[model samples]
Target: MSAPRFALGATVRIAERTPPVHHRVPSYAKGQVGRIVRVCHEHGLPEAYIRGDGRPFQRLYRVRLDQKALWRDYAGAAGDTLDIEIFEPWLEPAE
Candidate 1:
């Protein structure tokens, strides 16, 4: 319920965390650098919802990442990118 931690166009990196439960983010995306393209919504945390924690709220963002950065075997165009919606907790300012 606080102000968003990141603004649009901000560069961020997905946190490389491996929790015991499955996270919405794909494993290949961990540690990837991306830009915050859109702010989605304040929504319930999936982990909390499943645990019957009554659901905590958090900001969600759409992150745009270079496709090549995601796969070593990527043969797509240089401009190719992938946009993924991720919760704020999964992101950090890019180093």
Candidate 2:
């Protein structure tokens, strides 16, 4: 499928789905929205590398999400945020 490539500061949501095989997205980040801060170069899927099959390639990104948005109970500063390096397949345009 031709997924739209997001620009810097674009809003995106981590896919809330679970793949049958091993994946990189964390359970806590799923279904959450974040902003794309960096568009990383293409790389072999980490799961495939873990399986000794480093063949698949995809784009990666550094996404920034507000801490409070991610955790309702977050007690840190309102400006606090988290950055995650997520593969493109696990991301979707924020609806």
Candidate 3:
């Protein structure tokens, strides 16, 4: 069976602790507002070398966050936005 596909634009709840961590994705981003941007069809090597949970990866989502939301005392153009891709396991239906 194919891995299930999560809904885009669907709110998800992040695990208190889960999946592993990588440089691309930050730990502070956990339990934050992120929107699904795209879905990766192919499976590649696991990004988390520390966890060694490299199986097959699916459910890629593009999460957007405000610059001020991620940082404090921000001195950048107002309304700046940042985007990141996260796996399904990293998120669930947000309460």
Candidate 4:
């Protein structure tokens, strides 16, 4: 197996580009910054899977982001957060 691209607690930013075909990344997560909460299991890329390809398995991560950061007018408490499972390819290291 290959080494994990991100460790727990590492900060990451979701990629903002759109896929040419089907994808699993949620639209609301694009360009958002979050911290890796868990190193989830690896799986085949959804885009590739839909095309019937099975040679790829990308690391998945559970990232946590403040709800307020995702929405400008979030009405929830300051501590409200959203956790999302993201594939490694959709994430980039945040400075």
Poorly placed runs, candidate 3 (over 4 Å): 1-4, 13-24, 42-53
Clashes of each: 0, 0, 4, 0
- The TM-score obtained by model 3 is 0.62
**On TM-score, who's better, 1 or 3?**
1
lDDT score at residue 25, model 4, on the 0-100 scale: 88
Best by lDDT: 4
- In Å, residue 2's CA in model 3 sits off its true spot by 3.6
The prediction achieving the highest TM-score against the true structure is 4
For model 1, the stretches where C-alpha displacement exceeds 4 angstroms are none
Q: Candidate 3: deviation at residue 84, Å?
A: 0.7
TM-scores for all candidates: the values are: 0.91, 0.84, 0.62, 0.94
lDDT of 4 by residue, 1-95 (tens): 56889999999999998988888888999999999999988888888887687447888999999999999999999999999999999999997
TM-score of 2: 0.84
Error of 2 at 22 (Å): 1.4
Clashes of 2: 0
Better candidate by TM-score, 1 or 4: 4
lDDT of 1 by residue, 48-95 (tens): 666776367889999999988888999989899999988999999984
Weakest ten-residue segment in model 3 by summed lDDT: 42-51
For model 2, residues 14-42, the per-residue Cα lDDT tens digits are 98998778788889899899999998887
